[model samples]
Target: MADMQIDSSPVRTVNVTRYVTPLREGGSLPAIAEADDGFLYVLKFRGAGQGVKALIADLLGGELARALGLKVPEIVFANLDTAFGRTEPDEEIQDLLKASVGQNLALHYLSGSITYDPAVTVIEPKLASQIVWLDCLLTNVDRTARNTNMLVWNKELWLIDHGASLYFHHSWDNWAEQSLRPFVQVKDHVLLPQAAELDEVDAAYRAMLTEEKVRSIVELIPDEWLTASASDAIAADRREVYARFLTARIASSEIFVKEAQHARKSLI
Candidate 1:
């Protein structure tokens, strides 16, 4: 198996100690785990169905968000020893994975403490606008208003779950016109409380991201997740779109604050 070499600067400060508990399962990878150092981390392995590509997407996406200064959990790739091998679905580990679907990845076992109601998410309009900006720049279509995959901890909204994104890479270029569509119009359809602060957020994003870092992050994706030709095409398209989006965002220093303001007034 190829080892994922994360840039030492950004993630070196975080330490992943021991595996504490199993979090969730039933996806391409195994459940997340709690590290003995009192931090939450996910444990993944090379499996029969999914390959390194899935892991690559997760890592690269998370890293990109971190670069853009969004609130994201610190993710590190860990080698799960044989002791953490796959167990039966009825096994405790399998049960943990099953229950973790759709929640924030950081709180795997803490699901009981939180509810999944969209109405309860603490996303303000400004924050929602920034998230939409992230989605557009990454060409991520999975962050719909209904299934806003976010976690609110300590009154802050954190983003998660980029597995379903870059969907165009799965087959053909289905997102050609998506960029030209009216993203501002749909702003009223979601919750965003932080709309007035778009300039501040944009400044932070500009200061943190760079082309070299973006390329490095995307290149880290494994070949398995993009095994087939169709899969490769999807990944390629997504990469191109993302590159263009990032370049434009950086040059313009633009923010979609108006959309968020609309969403707030409409009570989305």
Candidate 2:
């Protein structure tokens, strides 16, 4: 595992107002608030017993994708300190505290009943290709053909939800080999025409997202979500897979088009 170079510095502080709203999904809680500087934010509270692992997954996944030169939403860790003096003190909350920014307003109020469909949100085949490529690199099995956890805002796709990855980390050594294997075939597919313009991804982004970064991110996950040794093993395995996928995508000239082709076929 390589050393991760993420700047664990605080970016900004935000005030969150806790007025919970309902989503169509029915389980998650959304809050509306404004940052100190007046920017709107949407804060989605993790469900009971889910802990802060979901938040960690979102933050780490978003950060890694951003480093890989993908167009993800501007996401940062947020702390939910209640007006009544209640504080989230679990490991998950503690990890979020390290990168806490401001609170967020629930997106449902801003976007209004936007269906979580890949075809509708990722309308372009080229963009879809990049998303699929990114997901494969991250080992995010949750973003399947049917349930695309994304938001289409200002004509762009914003990915969300990544707590399900690194599932194999619960137990195993040399997990990198398994993680890096799926990407051996990425070169065979076409990514996007625009990918040609993105010839070089920023080195700082790559350096910040080494295996160490993945481990640190994993450490923030609640122990309840993952037991001791098995969780560590799963995290290692997934990180290795992610690193290999990133290397292949960045270094290769080939594009991944299988998902895009399938998407197109479905449209016809």
Candidate 3:
């Protein structure tokens, strides 16, 4: 599974050589940092309030989107050094850097991108439905009108900030049953009104996401992120749990698709 490839490319890894400004808008305090590749990336620290769980969500959700032919910034493994942020003056930022001195997750920074504005930008029904379907599949509760978590770059909609997706993992209980349930939060989706093609795109999207593909994405999650949590077997088995949960959720995507369609009807 370690050699598995999505699009024949695995997520690349980079060393965080410089700490840039922090993106304070996020509760997790993700930063825009420079990597050893000489490219800038939006770093999602493993030591934030959401910890490694959020990073896992980011990786899983982003890769799932990419698998479905959506535009997501390139996700990467960011190695943070112990002495990375010693020069920072702020106490809070300093501590965050110190605790996050290990493997973290990051996305290629989309420079000069603007947050998606629903009032101005009009998305085609198919694309809108696809994005809505994706949010439903991930049970993402963050794509509300208040916080779109989307960006308009080069006149295209690119997804970002999926750390808020797969919220079920935060509690880590009854994951199987949770995967079978509907995503009731579909009602709050920003694109629900325009996602009129939900029914049309359902089958095609499901076909695109195979169990092996999902497991490959799950396998991308580092062992440290899985084992860093609990002392119990649940921690050791976390990766398998994620793979099973996603495959189950994809198998039962109709439950959430119907939920999204019904929610869309209400909006119109």
TM-scores for every candidate against the unseen true structure: 0.57, 0.52, 0.95
lDDT per residue, candidate 3, 164-217, as tens digits?
888878777888999999999899999999998987788998888888888888
Best by TM-score: 3
The candidate 3 region of ten consecutive residues with least summed lDDT is: 1-10
Residue 126 in candidate 1 has what lDDT? 58
For model 1, the stretches where C-alpha displacement exceeds 4 angstroms are 1-30, 34-40, 43-54, 86-118, 172-189, 192-208, 219-268
Considering TM-score, which of the candidate structures 1 and 2 is the better prediction for this target?
A: 1
- Note each model's CA RMSD in angstroms: 7.4, 9.3, 3.6
Better TM-score candidate (2, 3): 3
> How many steric overlaps are in each model, in order?
16, 22, 0
- Error (Å) of candidate 2 at residue 115 is 3.5
Best lDDT among the predictions, by candidate number:
3
Kindly give the stretch of ten consecutive residues in candidate 1 with the minimal lDDT sum: 100-109
lDDT of 1 at 177: 46
Question: What lDDT is obtained when candidate 1 is compared to the true structure?
Answer: 0.49
Write one digit per residue (lDDT tens) for candidate 1, span 90-142.
Answer: 56554433332221222223232232346665556556557765664554545
